[model samples]
Target: MDTLTHTQFTEAGLADWRDLAQGIHARFATGDFATGLRFVTAVGQAAEEAGHHPDVTLTYPHVDIMLVSHDAGGLTPRDLDLAGQISDIARDSGVSAAVEALVEVELSLDTADGQTIGPFWAALLTGSTDSFADGQVRDSGGRVPLLWFQDTDAHETPRQRFHLDVWVPTELAEQRIAAGVAAGGTVVDDSAAPSFVVLADAEGNRACVCTTDR
Candidate 1:
């Protein structure tokens, strides 16, 4: 499956789901454990039928779902189709959609020599460098936040070289940014608002609030 661009996905209008950096996420309020299990069962059946499955997380009264095409490295039409089907299942089960409940966080390392540092991070994070060949480090088990290097020219001055890349639903970007500001965080840059906004805490360390709305 080929990767879908942000515009293509946004144009598709997946109202029932939210696109995050890691995947498409949606939460269904199942009301109880049994109800949630039933919903998961239905989702499993739908996934089996479609030959694709989502990563599901069950909390009491809530079932969170995430879908991404790992091979394609992003969202595809298959994800959209499955999201639609899952929406149908949610409707049939009398579940409510909770779009605000999902977010994805990734770690980013700024380095001029990722090829050299990549191995160390992969080994420290995942115990192997197999995921380091392409200058991005990921755990094969998907158990850790992805660490990708941001290319930067060597600087003479020392600065914070690590930060978080927080990915959230498009609709929630502003709200999240505002919340961060209210929490004593400052928006250092919104030149790329909605797509990405750089924020810094009171101490001046930077992180980004990101969305796929672009």
Candidate 2:
């Protein structure tokens, strides 16, 4: 299946879900464990019927859902269809989408040689090298943040080489960056602004606040 571009996915009208990072994320309020399980069951049946599955999490009062075509390396029409079905199930189950529950984390490692270090990070993080590809590594279980190498020339100066790339809903990027600043973090760079803003802590450790608002 071919991957759907961000614009195409947006045009499909998935108001109940948020496109973040590589997946479409949604959280439904289930009210209780049993209700959450029931909702999950319904979603499972829907996914089974569609021949596509979503990454689902049931936590007491909420069920977080993420849909992506891992094989396609991005979202596809199948994901959009399943998302619509899932939205219907949520409505029938009386669960509402929780936008605040959506966020995606990715790890960036500055390296001069991605091929040389990719395998080590892949094995260390995922217990296998099967997820290593295109200078990035992802766990088979999809539970951990992806690790991607950022190529840079070797330098003798000591500095932080690893940083977090946090992708959140576009509307929330500014609020998040403000919260980080309020928490004593400084804005390192905002040339990219809403798309991506680099922030640094007191110790100079950097993390980027990223959005898919492009």
Candidate 3:
């Protein structure tokens, strides 16, 4: 159950899904609560049959699903298979995939001593030290965004230390960046275009627009 690389996941051609930091995500528009429930039920049955389950959120208008092999720490062939099955179920149910609506957000903290601060943040956020490992904090319940520490040199106070990592589908990255710019955000860096772009708000707070294309 080795983790699949981003390139491998992309090559799978899962048109309904986007590979994000946490896993491969997808959204299907059901247009109503009953329809969404039916879709979720079918997806659940399919997941049970495959012995691999996805995180599913069914709402009045849509159903969001994320697939990941936690034991492998990322996507694997099981995820790809389940994703295809889920997409097939969606098509059979006449639910349209809304890939553009898929997004994943993560919190990043710049710190010189993650070893010291990681545990503290993990305890505060997830109430367990087990979530603090390798400079990353992850909630098994998926109740909060993933938080990772970025190693940086020791610096003075009164500087920005926290920023957001916003993950979007590859096809929507440029459009998202453009919309941010139109909303008065500045593109501080595009040296990693199609991978990530740094954007700053009017007050200079920064966030990144990320895609899996790279």
Candidate 4:
């Protein structure tokens, strides 16, 4: 299966889901443990029937689901179909989809030598260096946020090296940015508006508000 582009996925009319990072994600408010369990059970059965499984996390108040085609390295038609089915299931179960609560976070490091440092970070974060690929460290179990390297020229010691890449729905990017700014963070850069906006805290540490709109 070929991977679906962000534009294609957005055009698919999956109102309950958002494409973030490498997958499509959705969160449903189950409101209780039993309801969440039942919802998860139904989702499991549906996934089994479709032969495509989504990573599901059930908490006391909500269930989070993420679907991606690992073989294709991104979203595929199977994901879209499963997402639609899952949405229907949520409706039938009387669970409300909390689209606004869905978000993905990634860690990024500015590095002059990712090839040399990737293995160390990968081993430390995931207990295996095998996750290191294309200047990024990915936890196959999804236990940790994706960590990618940003190539940069070597600089002096004591400079900031790590920052967060927060992925949110495109429509929420500006709102999130505004909230951050209102909370004392400053917009350091917006030259890449709609795709990413760099923001810095009062103390100068930087992070990015990112979206898949690009």
Ranked by lDDT, top first = 4, 3, 2, 1
Candidate 2 residue pairs in backbone clash: none
Over 98-177, each residue of candidate 4 has an lDDT whose tens digit, in order, gives 98887899999999999999999999999999999988999988899999999999999788999999999999999999
lDDT per residue (tens digit) for residues 1-214 in model 2: 8888778977998888888977899988888999999999999999999999999988998999999998898999999999999999899988888887678899999988899989988988988888899889978687778899999998765878899999998878999999999999999999998789999998889999998877
lDDT of 2: 0.90
Candidate with better TM-score, 3 vs 4: 4
Instruction: Please give the range of 10 consecutive residues that has the lowest summed lDDT in model 3.
Output: 1-10
Model 2 stretches astray by more than 4 angstroms = none
TM-scores of all predicted structures: 0.93, 0.95, 0.97, 0.98
Report, for every candidate in turn, its global Cα lDDT versus the true structure: 0.89, 0.90, 0.93, 0.94
Per-residue accuracy of model 1 over 77-181 as CA lDDT, tens digit each = 999999999999999999999888778899998889999999999999999878786778978687898899999998765789999999988888889999999
lDDT of residue 141 for candidate 4: 89
lDDT of model 1 at position 22: 78
Best by the TM-score measure: 4
Error of 2 at 89 (Å): 0.8
- Please rank every candidate by TM-score, starting with the best: 4, 3, 2, 1
lDDT of 3 by residue, 22-133 (tens): 8999999999999999999999999999999999998999999999998888889999999999999999999999988989999999999999999899999999889998
